[model samples]
Target: MTAFILVAGAHTGGWVWRQVAAGLRDSGARAYEVTLTGMDGGGGAAEPGVDLQTHIEELVRLIDRIEGQDVVLVGHCYGIHPVRGAADRRPGRISRIVHVDVGVPEDGDPALKLVPDQTDRERVLSLARENGAGTLPAPTVQEWQRWGSVAGLPDDALARLTEQAVPQPLPTLTQPLRLSGAVAEVPTTGVLCTANGSSIAVVEAMVGLGDPAFQALADPRVTFFELETGHWPMLSAPRELVNVLLRAAAGKGHRVAAVREQPTHLRPFLMDVEERPRERTGRVDLHLPDADGPRPAVVFVHGGPVPAGARPTPRDWPAFVGYAQYAANLGAVGVTVDHRLHELTAYGRAADDIAEAIELVRADPRVDGERVALWFVSAGGLLAADWLAAPPSWLRCVAASYPILAPLPGWGLAGGRFRPAAAVRGAGRLPIVLTRVGLERPEIAVTVEEFVSAAADCGAALEVIDVPLGHHGFETVDPTDASRDAVRRAVRSVLGHLRVGTD
Candidate 1:
């Protein structure tokens, strides 16, 4: 039987999950409402000397006991600390993680570090020191009602909660969560309380913009669900919360890019192509059109130069595969490859990886060996600038989207810095098409526009599609109607260019 481990938030114990755990058990699953050492009762002798490490070890010990069985670990509110720490230590033990109305922590993040209300935080800490012997006490019943934590609860339920809630260990709130990327591979679901009417994109964009603490929400592996209730869904909407957790456990809420989901019009034309037949540079899923003769192939390079030693996930495959499938459906061999990012500071090896991928894709019997095009996204466009400067006999055109076209501080390269603007001066006459998001990233938008202007000055037949309403990484992060339309038009234009010689 599968199991669900329910971890409660600050000033809470396993008692908070009583209804939720019972609901899970009634639904044919084993459930455990975990209480950290000091948070077990209203007031206990074991309430002293507890820290974040103690809480993390408690969950880890539970996982070790339940080894060899499928488990879904859930974290609510401040419980995200222990759950994330345990997940990082034993990622394989848990099949999925459900974050119920809580924020995920980044490596070395402590509680309240991301909180903006300094006065409120200080008040809570002062109250803990004064009343609970260095422990942060639970909010009063009236305070819970006023703060909306008990918004939809009945009077008796509210009273029970306030009576049972215990003081949280102060160390747990102050200790940093130590972690590595191991837990990053774990699939996470964010069950958001949307009674405030906040969408996932809006919330994530706000948090990701400046705060490194809320930055973990941007991880592609995270799938989101919104419930129309206040903060404490376990108390306010347990049944609905359970349903969402079950869906997440069954992997139903994710928006993954699988090859079979291609549109009907594109289905018959699409065929999966492996970009590298015998290399460890990572595989790219190529979707090629089914044509009678060899067709022009477009080698698609995706945006990321991921940090050193990070494992790639299926979330990383979607946007590029989507574009490749779109290109394939329109009569071209669309190749998408995950080129190697040599080091965090350099990308010369990425160039070699792309060159190898292009050659591998071009050599395929279904692809016309003499005709090829280049499609690059984000930083990939800058990496492909070398090829753009020295056009091959077979290379027809190049298309780039929201690309980082110039090198700035921090984005170091091998041998020398990334200077795409300079590279464009020598790019003889290769026709280039660029799609610029209106809500471009502050770091590279100006440089990209300057590069485009420089390329046009150097006599390259350049076309710029300006999507003023689109934001940086909109193709993947926030694919608006306008952004999708822009992509369709760009793909058609590039395919048209590639078909010139063959037609």
Candidate 2:
């Protein structure tokens, strides 16, 4: 019989996995819910010296005692640190390693780095030091959202989780996990919790960014499953978690394609147009029209969460260059910009960069300050929300191509700051153009549909150009006549809007 070892995240012990353990047992599998050292019912405050290594040793001993049985080790959130350390040590004995809603950290990476927010990390460290203890207290019930989304949890579950939670050892978060590289050979499964802001689509996007760090995710030995609940699926959807675990153990889950030598965005643009000379000014590049006397301008915003070290940034990309040149040929000044949208959390900084770029473009002697259109693509689409919320008179039109109108679940964006769908209600009299593809990812397509519905409900002047057989980056990926025609139509529509007040 196959034996499963379940490890919970910080502050909680084996007790958190009670329902999951019982569910696995009902399926004729042996389940062991582990409470790491220093956690409640697992030596607790008595083991003040408990660190990451101590937790790893605890799991290693359990795996050693389960003689002659196939072991599948499961780790949730912070528990992944020790689970990976243990798996690295016993790769030959482990059948599969299941990672629940957390990224697999590299050797020497501390759990403290996984917190994401710098403020929260400092707060955690301060709390541990001020308490005069070596432990960080669990977040209160009111503060639970800071840890992760509590979308599917019931009132009872929330209260129970808060009541049963214990202070976490400081060493576990600060101490790094040591790996000998053996765990890379072990089959791996990733259970992504979509409601908590992680989804396979996001993983695919990361891989598409041409980052070497994300390339390993395409390995055949690794697979993925997505849960529609928040972080704690054991409490919110135990039965579903059990079912997914069973399927994962059987090596049946979604497989992400390997990164191609050339990512879709890097492919050549669909439209063919004559090249125009571009004048580089700071971060913005201006492609001026031949017969220009203060020509109307179109600012092309590229998609991101791009790596900080990416070569030949967005402004120099083939599609951006192609669109810029095409606009210049159409008697309009084409502008492309480079912004520091290096991560999902850097949207605010990117927005500021775009705003600065626009101001510079408007001030240029070769561009018309009164007439301008904003064109956003892919992930950059969320940046359009600000302009749509309260468009200035100088802003003639806004256009998006395969845009993410709403934030994805795991992004953790608060309020309507970057949500274009919510801001569409305030887009009175502003001409908005949207280009959508048929073969887009479900997660992104849903956001597009939501924005469309909201625009209709609010009676916003929204124009949608549908590419029925195209993919997300269809301008490059699907370089058919349809793709070229769609691009031409979108450019024409935006240029038409720019000319409305001028003529």
Candidate 3:
């Protein structure tokens, strides 16, 4: 029989895993819910000075006690630190390490590094200092949503979570996880919470970035399962979480393919259009038509939270260049601009960058300021929300290709921010041309479908060109005749809305 050790995240304890533990036990597996040091599983004050090392020792003791059985260690969020540290020390005792909606930290990495945003990390540290007890207080009921998504949780469950939360020891966040590289040989499973801002697609995209730190994630022993819930799956969907755990123990989950020699975005564009002469202006690149007269401009927006040091930036990518050149050949100005969306939380900054780029494009002497269209690609789709909600007279149309129209479940975006599916209701007469692919990732396809349904409900002027045989980044990845034809149709439709020849 397989034995499981479940560790809960920050501010919580074994109580949080009650339902999941019960479900696992019902399935004939032995489940052990651990209440880490510095946390309270019952109505009692937390122990002081309980650092990450304390938690690791506790887990190691538990693993040693469980003899003659295969052990699977499950870690969620902050719990991953101790679980990983313990696994590293007792690799032979651990059959598999299951990571739930958490990052894989390397040697000397702290839990604070998982926060991603520097400002947020600083705020957390500040809060810990304010306590004067070497502990960070639990988030208030209202603040819980900011810590991790509260989606799918009932009001009572949320209330219980808030009331039962315990202060986290500061050392747990500051102490670096020490590893001996022994755990690297152990099989691993990643349970991605799609609603909480993680998915298999996101993992694949990161691996494709050629970052050596993430290369290990593409290993054959590392598999993945996606849960369509928030960070606290044990609370929001216990039964489902239990099932995934069981499957993960059997080494039966989706396997991520090895990264290709060339990344998908860097591949050649499907259409073989000739390059046009372009002028560079800061981050913006302008491809002007030979006709010389002021022409309608199509500003192409590339999607990302791309790395700042990525070579040849988005504007210089072959697909963006091809799209720009194709538009220029059709008697229009093709514009591509690079923005600083280096982190998922930087969408606001990205939106501002795009707005600034548009103003610069409109002010260009070779472009007609009154006739402009915005073509958004990939994750850049959310940036169109503001324009769709309140379009300017000069904005002729909007276009998106395999775009993420709604914020994924755990992105923690403001409720009213960058929600194109909801904003499409107010689009009025502004035209929208969406190019969707059949093989798109489920998480992204859901957003596109949501936007389409909303547009239909509002009777908005929306046109969808389906590429049944294509995939995400189809312009480069699925270079079939269908992909090429869809791209051509989309360009013509956007230009038609711009009234390029009619003017």
Candidate 4:
């Protein structure tokens, strides 16, 4: 039998792992729940001196008491810090690490540095500083719920959580992690919770565009699985969570360079894009309905002429799958494709890829062919100007979200030359839904206004969706209720205009 040690996140204790341990024990494994020194309310640890070192030492002591040779160490959220620190200290005793909802750590990274968004990072830093002593108070139950955890949990569960949660020591968040190269040799698995909308797939999409917070998933040794719940999977999704853990512990879930197996929730609607060699020119993933007659299809183009050294695989980004899945749920065939990122001919190559992708989708027997729509996001919108200018007869609608409508200073050689104003004159007569971010950079707004003026003057069919207070990458930056509602409305409007089914 294998020994499984569970480590809890900040402000919580081993109590959170009780249900998981019960599930594990039923499967014939020894499960040990760890309560860090300060968090377990013992040995004067409640005082202000608890830091990263204190928690790491606690885990080391636990492993020794168990007298285990092959240990499967599991960590959730903030618990990753100590779990990883201890792994570094005793690499020979650990067999595999399961990073649930949280992620594997890189040496020298403090907790705050791992947070992706700037606004949220600053807010956390401010909160830590406000505590006169080196500690940040835990959120009340209401605050935690608002922050998107324990989705669909019962009242009793919520009450138990509230009673057990405590303020986390600030030094743990501020202290840098120290690791030896030996820790990287251990196999690792990452579980992404999808109910909050920031699934592993969503993070990978940001990584495709070079988001540093998600770069860890790109590691070859890490295999990822998605759990359809909030951040607290053990509380809300114990059955599914436990099954995944059992598979990981048995060494059955390692995907080195393969297409991800579809999550159980998405298997009914989605089909992965076939994987090809890294040098393959173009690729697209498809999402379809069960009925299987010719269905309306919406093609998605992501933003980027990726920088010099930031190379990502075609199927790596989750936004493509997420949007495609969203379309499938709405009764439309959803397609997300990749285009060439050429520096000299940035717009030219990506536009050509879009054209090629549309041709392919139109020829597919599963797609309605005549009722196809195009969705362009960010820089990909700039590449799609020509398609919007001279759209095909089958093109019924077009939606551009936080798009770069016109060229600006330092834009590539062809950027200033390709004009949206001139292109609108010959554009096909189609309903164009343009979504603008209110809190975006000043220069982006200026360019978008220029294109809006040109499209309106040319008598083009257009409807504007202004996401006030939404940032440039609002969907992923921070999906507030208002922002999500705005994006959903924009998607619905585009699909409705295309006459796509919503069953």
| Steric clash pairs (candidate 4) | none
Tens digits of per-residue lDDT, candidate 2, 415-496, equal 6789999999999989999999999877778899999999999999999999999998888889999989999999999999
- Tens-digit per-residue lDDT, 1-503, candidate 3: 89999998888899999999999999999999999877864333446667888899999999999976589999988899999999999999899999988878778988877764445677768866775346677878987766666777888999999999987877788778999999898899999888777889888887776656677889999999998887788999998999999999999999888866888878998887876899999999999888867899999999987877667689988899999999999889999999998877789899999999999999988899999999999999999999999999999999999999998755657567689999998899899999999998877888999999999999999999999989989998998888889999999999999997776
Write down the TM-score of every candidate: 0.48, 0.85, 0.84, 0.54
- Report lDDT (CA) for all predictions: 0.70, 0.88, 0.88, 0.71
User: Per-residue lDDT for 361-463 in model 1, tens only?
Assistant: 7777878878888988877777866876677888888888888776543232322235677677766777777888888755567678788788878887788
lDDT at position 90, candidate 3: 94
lDDT of 1 at 44: 38
Question: In model 1, which regions exceed 4 Å deviation?
Answer: 42-46, 114-116, 124-133, 145-149, 201-220, 254-503
Q: Which has the greatest TM-score?
A: 2
What value of lDDT does candidate 3 attain over all alpha carbons? 0.88
TM-score of 1: 0.48
Provide the lowest-lDDT 10-residue window in model 2.
Answer: 40-49
TM-score of 2: 0.85
lDDT of 2 at 407: 83
